[model samples]
Target: AALAGQRLDVAAEAASRARALAPNEPDVHFLSGKVALARGDLDSARGHQERALALDPAHSGAMNELGRIRLRRHDTAGAIRHFINAARTTPGEHIYSRNIDVVILRTLSRMIYVFVLVALLMLWVPAVMHVDRFPFAVGFGVLAAGAVASFGLVLLRLPREARGLVRRTLRTRRVATALFVAIGGVAVAFAAVAFVPPSELPQTLPIAILITIAARITATARLRSPVSKNQRPGDRMT
Candidate 1:
């Protein structure tokens, strides 16, 4: 009941009692680990989760918690492994599936870092060739608009319940905010290109990085879709 209610203090007391009563019980260790996680003792949480996994090797919940802990510690690979294990061990568990998708997104983010570098290098062609400014501006605007459109598409797929919170965040000035940021990004790009020396000019890289980041941010925002071998579909709940 305590765990269900997310009353971690009460759950901790119950877990302590359970551990005393059944020292070898995997569930007790799992409960204790959950409590430690709630208290932000990641090391303790990880140890208890490992102990639970050792006792019950098929404990999907323990694997799920371990994955979350690994993510907290910035161990993306480990997190993905544990999350995959949990999802494979218990395919019906929503938490495991959701977490696996999230871990996959973290992995994709690393790939995007490389993409940013390459895309920036490609952008240099336009700068070096002295491409017509109007055409270059049009191309950049199209890319930016595409990124924004992707974000809007992703937003449409959000759960009905979550839309409220996201809408609240957008408020009534989102258009104004987007225009301000877009104009500012364009101004910065122009300034960098105009002021930086030809031999030393590396403005394309930064501009490419910014554009790629925006594109990938939209991709990240769409990550809940379960359209892959290891991915699970979003839950249909309020």
Candidate 2:
């Protein structure tokens, strides 16, 4: 059954028939586990699925089901790992894509909110009160530093070996990268104008525009074409 909530008896019968037809088939065992899961026999479901996975490490279905079970049990990190492995094996399934996307979107949203709040604090805390002699410089310096760090983070590829770290980084930094780039550009522009001679402002504006253009072009190129050397699309596999 495609749906996981289907009748277990029916699924079990089907799995039995399948297993009879192909004894030792990993998929048959996997199907039996799905049936058990539908019947709310989690322990049984896990046993069958684990057996299936033991038979075939790359069994995407077993991996995904294990991921689902782990998620239901509140093992979010472990569940994410299983899901990531399933995605890596199949790389083209809609279910796997959706799972990863859901995880990533939720994590990114939370991180973005926190990063924005922090950015505001960095900009406002010293400048509004004029506590420091170079309050603007201190604030803008922090902004620029954050920007560079955030940009570098986006460019870092997700490590297949470090699934948890990669997942968290990808999930949190996806949209945060773009936002930081914009903020970085503005900060750079302000810094240049503040420091550069008034006569240089005309030249500085063009350079700032050039920087913006370059960043946009870089981002677009990363998106529409094959990955450039040392760079990848935000959502691409590492």
Candidate 3:
């Protein structure tokens, strides 16, 4: 272990010397970034890593380092996003896989919480209790069905592989997901209000709309993780 540490120290010094000789070399910047990260100089590490990535956008090392920095900062969502890009560019890397796994589990846990909340809310809402009392049950059910379909539509629109081409395609359709999610949420709110008594519709609709809008916004932001259809099993990074 001592020998290994010494070797790392020597390598770090060599990297510094290389940087001094060739300041614009992407590999030198990448190595210096790694050494700074090892020494816990996160800010300096980020500077070097970003410089390396700027010098060579295809540098998987720099991309992975930036992702690691985001992970350490507790920005799991951002970390996952960056790691996905790194993984796409370097599919054999185990580091990207490990980081991506952590983020995936975290995201799943949050999604479970949201699902549970939605289930509970559906059960307890007064409009749901007396379903037969509402004259608009048919319309409400239709709207909710549409909501479910909208979610599926978003999933369908996602690319089968997360590569340069897929990212470009997604960027082109950036507003589509947000728009669907927003409209679907509004539909759900109106459906929920349709169950209420006619007298309470005016009072309840606005509040329900606001709450639904907030929930939709949160869900849209949280679900921004990569969706790749052709990701190979045991690919290490994808």
**Winning candidate number (TM-score):** 1
The CA lDDT of each predicted structure is 0.63, 0.60, 0.60
Q: Give a tens-digit lDDT track for model 1, residues 17-109.
A: 999999899988998998898889999999999999999999999998898898789776566577778878988877776664444444434
Q: Estimate, for each residue in 1-238, the C-alpha lDDT of model 3 and write its tens digit.
A: 2223756677667777889999999988987888787777889889999999989998988888887787678765566667778877888876675556545434333443454345336533445454443535554465456555644553344334323332333343323454455545655665567666657865785677575656555555534545455431121332
How far in Å is the alpha carbon of 48 misplaced in model 2? 1.5
lDDT of 2 by residue, 1-238 (tens): 5335556676788787887898788988988887877777888889889989999988999998887776667555666677778878998875764565454443444444444445445433332453442665766677667755764564353335434544444544334464555456556654654566555556665665555545444433322343234432234321
Order of quality (TM-score): 1, 2, 3
| Selected candidate, larger lDDT, 1 vs 2 | 1
For model 1, the stretches where C-alpha displacement exceeds 4 angstroms are: 3-6, 109-220, 224-238
Q: Can you list the residue pairs that collide in candidate 3?
A: 160-229
- RMSD per model, one decimal: 11.4, 9.6, 10.7
Better of 1 and 3 by lDDT: 1
Global lDDT for candidate 1? 0.63
